[model samples]
Target: MLGKKKPLIRGESAWHKGWKDLFPESYREVSFPDKLLGDLHRADIFTSCGTTLEFQNSPICLDELRSREAFYPKLVWVLNGKKFKGFKILKHLPDVDDPRLDPYDFCLGEHLSVYRRAELHSGAARPLNFYHPELRNIPFTSYYYSFCWKQPHRVWYEATCPIIVDLGGHFLYQLKQRPQLGESYPYLHMITKKAFVSQYL
Candidate 1:
């Protein structure tokens, strides 16, 4: 819907440019007035469905994260997971009932803590039966995958909006987490890139 091609902004990374190129110019760099702050907020991509997609390449603190969420209520984060050297995507859901997985060796809210199961069993267990008191709340039916990230930015755990990571594969993984007994259990939900793009287009 754009009449003319807009000039590229300074220091815009190729990662951002690549994703923006997939959409029409009108949807890329769409701006909205922040009446509460008397300023304008520009979104990376604003789709026909009114969902604002923010392409994040670097780490951001909790304050900025909250501010962006507040400014754009219907927001979805498309993060560049390749930049994170510590981030590792393990095989699909591990067996929580496996005795090798020591329930006592986990730290509250740490993603790496639970990934120990992946190292121990590596998706060898069957049926996905979870008997441990700490694992009771998790929804096993979801397309959840175990992951381990060394010292992942804690701010992401605070994100209230949907977040999907681009790890340079055929699919984008949605980061799903739930707080139980003051502890955090984070996992990944895989969706093909074709499916993700088709939905917005």
Candidate 2:
């Protein structure tokens, strides 16, 4: 009993473990005991800046989502975008436009909160091809893109904190939801993984 092995946390995946490994050992799996709730909440990575990164790979109920947000005031959800099979990222907002759509609808893209006639691909294998070999090269800068998720987990929309998505690429996307006419619109900010990790370190 003195040298017992600890069991892996329930629902922990290799992707979760890999993200945790990037941080210092002390910052990983830091738990806070709450007297009022009579339960402990362990953050995947509690940064020195007092931000808790919660890596969510599965669908979470509204109750649990609100509870965690309340528990960790400075929380940022690091969602596993790969979990959603129907997630698709379209081209940058600037290059995409359809003559069929009205000005307002065209600007919003093919999103749930709005309707548009642009025939975006159901499934996109890569991020927007902003670069072309024939064209002169310019340093790449991060840009926001409109996305279409088949059945997105809307629970995250109610969250007060920031939500960063891991799309398994050279970059991590920060999901920003803007409220327009009492509806939530989704957009992704393309950021380099190195830049994101550096802030925590």
Candidate 3:
């Protein structure tokens, strides 16, 4: 079993503090050695329950994020501490047969994920667009959602099951509405907070 883990305190950043406060049992700033995962990588927040949470505030290339999400048993939860963007909980399963070690092939691999057919975890027929001056030349990019594209350095993005979520306020609470169960393949869908409260509350 993993030992008692604590988050690295560079300073009291509110986002970090929020997660640490909410899930005190999770280990913070975790690193997986080379090839143990696909590559040497670090997770901001991880739990023994088989999920890893990635936090985003700055602009990062989507390809990089997509590659990273596949390494977990259930890398659920894209958490945003800021109120502008809410949080999303993804239903994830690694494409690899085993997670404790890399595939014996020791080369690159593709991932497969699916969603709850009822929605909140389904696929998007449209390609979600995102804009950054840096993104102008990038192919297949048509950044959507003007509300989230307010300005640079203030937005966050998470691609769940291939659906893009530009979260808004009360993100943690948004996750309480569990999405419907579906097949396991890569896709992203979101559930309504109201649906969750009515069903589980």
Candidate 4:
């Protein structure tokens, strides 16, 4: 339901380059070629495994992150001010969670059409999740209950944690951890998601 996009602060070219450079040997601006409800929603990078990604150079709150999970697999946000006009903007805007407001902002329907399609096409018997575990800010039981409505069977509810990397004290990168239970979203343990303290540094 959190659908208010920040004022457009970044250019298309910067966003395209940023996301494309991060994930090499992957498809660029890969999107649903076929016409959906309206103009298609394109992922910045489509991994070989069909996991989609969108890079944003903007301030994305925890609730906003959860709202976006209903669409794509992950969103790599730029923490550096030098990246995008002092802020980030994404190429494709995802749909608002509320079905009524969906004007193809997210090509997938509220019924989770994209997730179903990916599951059907791929042979991997992984969990068919609409939202990524790193983005779901809700309680454990409530989260699974919603997933049930989206994917009842044949999907494993594997969760993942994130490793936030402080990029030279200016930028940050959130690397996702392996999927498992008891490992919740990273924001829970933080006073603020922007606080970057990495042991590796």
Candidate 5:
């Protein structure tokens, strides 16, 4: 557990106050891996706040904000093995002209602003399913799960599953069935890994 102390403010701008105000309780300046930060930027879901709450990062990309319905705030929580460390808060649509701030920076906001999906997908097709044998103890009508692909560049998807408890049942279950070929999953499909680098690299 992180020590119960205030985080050291680093950035030397007015925004530092905003960061302090956003997370007034407990904060710390822990160094994180740059590669991990890059991944979060690509996913558009990392936040300044450390791991603890669900609204640690934003899930939407800047390019997708043109759509009226795409303006909701999203969170992305990155897990390093079993421990959760880094996060980013994307609150709103960013000003396009600002050179100092990337579109990724403006994605922070309240957690409730984001949408929650119950099914994980690869593009338009569902790529996976989840089953938890311990769902009976959870209070929600559903639970959230994360999905990733074997190949890099493939986008991840998340979905929730309904929880049903029977008397004396001790298991909560979720399934991640792989999507069939030729189906549209949550992310775009392309040529194999070798083919991609051969053409681009």
Candidate 6:
């Protein structure tokens, strides 16, 4: 019963020379230590959201640090799981080496896709009767159960908690621990799906 949306795909752009012109005015005066800049220059790719930056090489960039300042100042708030505007805007660039050309992927779908999949896999199962220690801590059970029972209203409420609490918890932890590194979508997708299964179904 769920609808599927097409994925958004973007290609990499040409490399730019200086941080001074590329970043916002606020970041003009900021300086990257020489070692970090050297690493960035060697990287095969660079990708960033307003709040996070990922590089293929060992070096980090000054823009990434500044992006964190704008998007993740509090460090605890969950960023809305939305696509970055830069992904689409940068897609318009003609040059392949444009900084915005970093390859990126986005899947389009409603939040309930995960919840619905869990429900399908847990047909006719009673709530809390299943024994799975790994899933005991996940908070999406209520939503999954509601969907299984054909109760759409309950599904909405239950779905939101797990999506926020379970996903947000791990997301923040990862950002805090690995702020400079970028994650591939497939890896994150698998982790999120597995977490949803563990918590609810």
- Every model's TM-score: 0.73, 0.73, 0.39, 0.32, 0.16, 0.17
Clashing pairs in 1: none
Number of the predicted model whose lDDT against the real structure is largest: 1
Can you tell me which runs of candidate 2 are displaced by over 4 Å? 1-10, 94-142
Candidate 3's TM-score: 0.39
User: How many pairs of residues collide in each model?
Assistant: 0, 0, 19, 5, 47, 10
* TM accuracy, model 6: 0.17
- Across 124-201, the per-residue lDDT of candidate 3 in tens digits comes to 422212232322233331211112112323212344432223354432222221222322222223444344223312
- TM-score, candidate number 5: 0.16
| Candidate 5 whole-model C-alpha lDDT, 0 to 1 | 0.24
**Candidate 4 TM-score versus the reference:** 0.32
Judge candidate 3 at residue 110 and give its lDDT: 28
Writing each residue's lDDT as its tens digit, candidate 2 over 1-201 gives 497544556778888888888899899999999999799999999999999999988889999998999999799889999888678887554322223213222234463223222323333222222233421132323376778877878887777888889989889988886543324456788889899999989
lDDT of 3 at 167: 52
lDDT of 1 at 20: 85
- Badly placed stretches (over 4 Å) of model 1 are 1-8, 94-142
User: What shift in Å separates residue 120 of candidate 2 from its native position after superposition?
Assistant: 24
Clashing pairs in 6: 12-101, 13-96, 13-97, 13-98, 13-101, 14-96, 14-97, 14-98, 15-97, 135-198
Worst 10 residues of 3 by lDDT: 100-109
RMSD of each predicted structure: 7.9, 8.6, 16.6, 18.8, 20.5, 20.5
lDDT tens readout by residue for model 4, 70-132: 455554333333332322211221222434222111122233222222333455424333355
Query: Candidate 5's residue-wise lDDT over 1-201, tens digit each?
Result: 877754444532332333223433333232333363252122211233322212112233433332211222332222121111232212222222233222111111222111112221323322211122222222221222222333322122332221111111222122222232223222111123233213212
